[model samples]
Target: MIQKSIFYTSILLIVVFISSGFKPYDNQIDKWFDLDNTDEALYIFPSQKNTDYTYLNAPFKGKFFVGYKEAIGFKESQNKYRKVNTLGYMGKYQFGAETLKSIGISDSLHFLNNPRLQEKAFVTLLSRNKFILQDYINKYEGKVISNIKITESGILAAAHLGGAGSVIKFFKSNGERRVKDEYGTSVRSYLKEFAGYETKNIPAIKNAKI
Candidate 1:
């Protein structure tokens, strides 16, 4: 009786393993290559997509951009806008260096110029009980973090290292401004793939220890 039970259990385990096959736990490569019909392709592959969402997402999520234009006459111009956006996820936080690079962002951009974005993301993650930026800070051994200013245009952020030379300027304008917004478009795309990967592969990788 014992031998028969052992054989049945072994067969069941073999069947389960064979059915599962080789599922990708971290399919960042696959997700990167598969460009969807959303703004994520643009932000992640700006060169390939030749797109910028800095304007669109800025307003709803409260973002603005500061720029200057030449005056047609003998008058000065003064206008400034900030772009804002928000993205939500339903699972674990799993962003990293390779993923950032795959999306056309480098360590300099991720670690340096994107502090505000990261912090806001961290806050959002905390709200959802998904992950914590403190975990990254702990793992990375105390990286620099800067406090950001919040306004109607959203949260202003910068890194001490790469953002040193960056500046925001105001200009006066005599006419109304009209332009299309596409900043938050990519937020949807990013969330889709990000959530998909988190839901699909994260468990397998976590459970591989046994």
Candidate 2:
């Protein structure tokens, strides 16, 4: 009688546990490669995209890569070739000195003075950032959270404002932990503001340099 009672109790517990619907927590970490990428977590772009697609009227250019960069340029420095912000960020795209050096641009003056080099620097940074955030893109792209649609272009633009880490945090929190710059700009804003541009073509190159 005792053995039968214990067996019935065991069966009852098992059924209750199975019906609870308990499962493992899902996150980006489980989806990434198994490598100690701590050093890569520190890296950090953008134009301020508002309702100003008419900033260029080059026949559907607003939706292309060209329009995307220009809108960002206008937002950064109002399209000024030699713009240097009070915070010491340089050029039309408002690149910080350290970030410029990461892409092989050391001479701050030369970078500010050369429009071609600055343009090259912008694209190179985009390619590298896209590479770093590729997995995030793969996971979050087309998923709407907080009523905002996610896309590769928006991911890169947000990474431009904050680093890839901030973006990862945003996704890990399911869009709850939005980081911000001193200018009161949030990562989520960039993600939403710059969505649906032609940045899918930017090559995902590791260590991309100008």
Candidate 3:
């Protein structure tokens, strides 16, 4: 009788422990199981933290691989030399027909087919943006807006994404004037991601060649 009574007590204790969310040390399972990755906890956790913007606050130094014009190209079209998006933005740098025409690329088919032309077009656009936003870059570079330290490369990248006018507005408003493309990519995002790079080689020209 005592044995049976002890067994019932033990079972009751186990049930109570489980109901109270208690588990033995050996029985503890990972709380992160099957949880969506976008969870705040995942973002805050040290082990799982994203390092995408770790260099945002770092000193102005160039990065390799996806740096300079190539980074912009990758962001636009994943560096696909022969690709064209649904919006008709063509080639590796995803230049619209109008933008291409402005840079002296009249034939969209020829521009899309020629990888060299695409590269030149990117440089030409960058040069043009540099000229247009030179004052803003000089004024805002090294200044922090919305916790992000502005850099020349960052300003240039933002200009590439949302035009020189949009970049000027973004900085002038202290990041209050939010500008995002159809892909929901914001100027701030580009500024943070592409903060440090060497673009001084590309001269600011009134009419850069494509």
Candidate 4:
């Protein structure tokens, strides 16, 4: 009786092992272990079906052009699409009436309401300013003035704050001229604060249209 019971127990263990081997293949945990070259074996490839939030997860601005634009926009109006300041600067980058018109936007109401147009205006203005200040940028882009490093992005930001003319004047005076807006935000401050960002992707075009 003991020998028969032992023999039955051995048969049951063998059957259980074989059944486990025949079960469905579960790649849930092992799928991560599957390596590939596209994702460099680090993570699963992003598929439209399952992948969401492919944006760069960083919170603060980096050295990229997108980060540069978003950072300037945040400072201008906290990235508000329809924000209008007390001085009547419109949209995300806070363009004045004349500034809007300079970019071929005559309808202030349309510019104030249209976010896409406002964004285009910002980039277009950058291109225009870059063209206007090409001489100054070429002259003092890498130089240090008043303990502040002069850069293309800085010059463009200052131009946005005041104007391309102000940026040129500041550079011409060797950083001596301390021009300020109605709110007392100095061109020098914008130059220092917005220094060192990627803005070379914007081509220098005279009379850049929206």
Index of the highest-TM-score prediction: 4
Which residue segments of model 1 deviate by more than 4 Å?
Answer: 2-15, 18-24, 31-56, 59-210
Go through the candidates in order and give the clash count of each. Answer: 26, 2, 0, 0
TM-score against truth, every candidate: 0.14, 0.70, 0.68, 0.71
Cα error, residue 131 of model 1, in Å, equals 53
lDDT of each: 0.25, 0.83, 0.78, 0.86
How would you encode candidate 2's per-residue C-alpha lDDT over 84-114 as one tens digit per residue? 8888988988999989888888999999999
Instruction: Report the candidate with higher lDDT, 1 versus 3.
Output: 3
lDDT of 1 by residue, 69-177 (tens): 1110001111111212132111112224433333334443343345454433323322222121223213322221122121211101111101101111100111111
lDDT of 3: 0.78
Judged by whole-model lDDT over C-alpha atoms, candidate 4 comes out at 0.86
Task: Summarize candidate 3's per-residue lDDT along 112-207 as a digit string, tens digits.
Answer: 888887887888888988899888888888889998999888888888787788898887788998899777889999999888777767688876
Q: Worst lDDT window (10 residues) for model 2?
A: 39-48
Model 2 TM-score on a 0 to 1 scale: 0.70
